[model samples]
Target: MLDRDIAAFYGVETKRLNEKVKRNARRFPNDFMFQLTEQEWSLISSQFVMTSRMKRPKKSLPYAFTELGALMLSSVLRSPVADETSIKITRAFVAMRQMLTFSTLPEKVVTLAQELYKLKEEVNEILADQNDINESTRAQLDAISTALAELQASRSQDATLKNRRPIGFIQPKEDEE
Candidate 1:
């Protein structure tokens, strides 16, 4: 279960929930519960948060309890509701693990999805670059075509001028009388 959703289920503020775990720190040994690193937190945040949100505000993400930690938490928690919820959570975790074991495709699907996302980004970047290059090439070709058309239109006038020139006006031989 996601930390946020778990927090909501326990009917406590996420900070207060973390504080309870912090106060009873020894129950959560390193393996039982661990704080998410900055990178791990960011990845989780990106996964959970909506893309439309402009910025993801950073927060002190707390230690997440594993199965052992959650069971230990059930013992320490003061409320009956929390204890009951913990049992349910534990069962859910077990069920999820079982489901994962049953499915061979889950791991492969995740890997393939990550690779596909990377490839899509690369392809989009390449297409944007290609579009820019193509536009420039088209503009250059249009300019060249316009210049050729103008040169062709002027060729007849130049030919007429050459034909109109008198032969006497042509340069005389050096020995002419």
Candidate 2:
């Protein structure tokens, strides 16, 4: 990336970015960044429409940055925009690296899916066992209820017999006029 483009992406002015680079000169080595020749600058600048406000002298060539240079530039720039953008760019690169590193994602997913399936099957078996226990408990409770009902009927019959008079007793009491 060019310094101007990088600065624009980082929400800083081109001049400010260059100023920070100049201040931290050792931070950017030759491989990390280079200046475009006048002829190269001319070709590049011609590609973009330059208004009167955007006009610059031929001597003022833009600095070209490699990926490392751009990252270093972000670090050198201590402003909030640069800091936040640097963190984002760093995270993006890290994510890319992680994506590349985790090439076995499918295998991991398959393993996890198998484990989950086993867990689901185990849960179903436990539920089935609990249902069997519940059914047996319900049957026992029903049997106890029926037995209690029969005992209650027999007690009620005995009570009724005790309350009735003897079948052969017919006379009224002598004391009763």
Model 1 Cα lDDT, one tens digit per residue, 2-88? 345566667776666677787998777877878877787667667854641233235555456677777776666668878888889
Index of the highest-TM-score prediction: 1
List the global CA lDDT of all models.
0.74, 0.82
Quote the positional error of residue 135 for candidate 2 in Å. 78
Clashes of 1: 0
Error of 1 at 138 (Å): 82
The number of the candidate with the highest lDDT is: 2
Which stretches in model 2 have alpha-carbon errors above 4 Å? 49-53, 87-177
Distance from true location, Cα of 123 in model 2, Å = 56
Clashing pairs in 1: none
RMSD of each: 16.6, 14.1
Residue 65 deviation, candidate 2, in Å? 0.8
Q: Residue 175, candidate 2: how far off, in angstroms?
A: 99
Candidate 2 residue lDDT tens string, 44-157:
877877722254455678899876787897779867887787777667767777987798888899999999999999999999999999999999999999999999999999
